[model samples]
Target: MKAIVLAACLVCMSNGAEYVVVVSKKSSFGALSVSQIRDVFLQKRRSLGEQKTIPVNVLGHDEVRAAFESRVLGMDRNRLNAYWVKQHFQGVTPPLTQPSFESVKAFVENVEGAIGYLPGSMVDAKVKAVYEF
Candidate 1:
């Protein structure tokens, strides 16, 4: 498990990008605890305080996605897949997905209350990072 995590970190570092959870600059949603983030991502918590929150994900198995899953979600891909499968049966769908970091940033920027993760280097004035991993 440690080896896998190390590898994931190394992969991100090798690409010269650190990952962070971000929200629109206009969003009032502040920083979040890991458990809070977990709940939001899992669809256990629908909103951040009074504001409706939308969690966005990067499509496919990108390295940044893998790192976020391992470090923040604390679940392997297979386990997460199974969990989502069960969620599907219950009619709880996974978060919306964007094709790449650029699209994720765009979505979060344009959509109010939207949140997502991306490489730290990609963050700009349009988005505010709520958490770092």
Candidate 2:
């Protein structure tokens, strides 16, 4: 079992896939915690302080999205589906989805109060990375 776990970790590390949570450079938030990021993505909290927050989602099958969901949000697909269904019944909606990480990054850069996660390598000066995983 330990060997299997180690092998999986090695595979993940070998992929060189690192992820970052970013907000527009103009956003008031800085260095947010993982829990805060989770809340933003889950729509549990709408704003960071007085700034209205918009959370963006990358393509559903992207590895970055998978990493964010597992490492940051701490939930699997089944749980997320159930949670969203429950929230939907309550008139709550999930974050908006983008076709790719580049699209997500672009949206975050152009939109005030926007927050999203993507490959760390995709980050640039227009956005501030608030968290990494």
Candidate 3:
């Protein structure tokens, strides 16, 4: 049992697949706690660290996006689809879904009140990691 647990942890750690959620280095939000992050993602909180929040999503299907959904939002693709489907017509959509991390970063950097995540290697000094999952 211990070995299995260790293996699972190792699997999660290998490459440390996830870094932290980041925004442009110019952002005022340097870091965030999990609950604070959850609030922003869920649209429950209007701001973080003196800046309004805009949470963006990765489009349709991407492996890293999948990780963000499951690992971060605690929701599966099906649930996510259902969620968007429900939000689509309400004139509300789940963030502006982007095709890649680059786009997300661009959006965040260009716009205030924006937040998104990319892989660790993709993150540079331009963006500051707000939270590490």
For lDDT, the strongest prediction is 1
Query: What TM-score does candidate 1 get on C-alpha atoms?
Result: 0.86
- For residues 25-74, what per-residue lDDT tens digits would candidate 2 score against the true structure? 98889899999989999999999889999999986777778878889999
lDDT of each: 0.91, 0.89, 0.76
Error of 3 at 23 (Å): 1.0
Task: Please give, for residues 17-109, the per-residue lDDT of candidate 1 as tens digits.
Answer: 478999999999888988888888989888988989899999999999999999999999999999999999999999999998999999999
**Model 3, span 1-133: residue lDDT tens:** 9999999988766756365688777777766877777667766577875678889876778878777777777889899778768767776556666888789888877887788878777777777887766
lDDT of 1 at 60: 98
Report the backbone clash tally of model 1.
0
**Model 1: how large is the Cα RMSD against the reference?**
7.1
TM-scores of the candidates are 0.86, 0.86, 0.76
Best by TM-score: 1
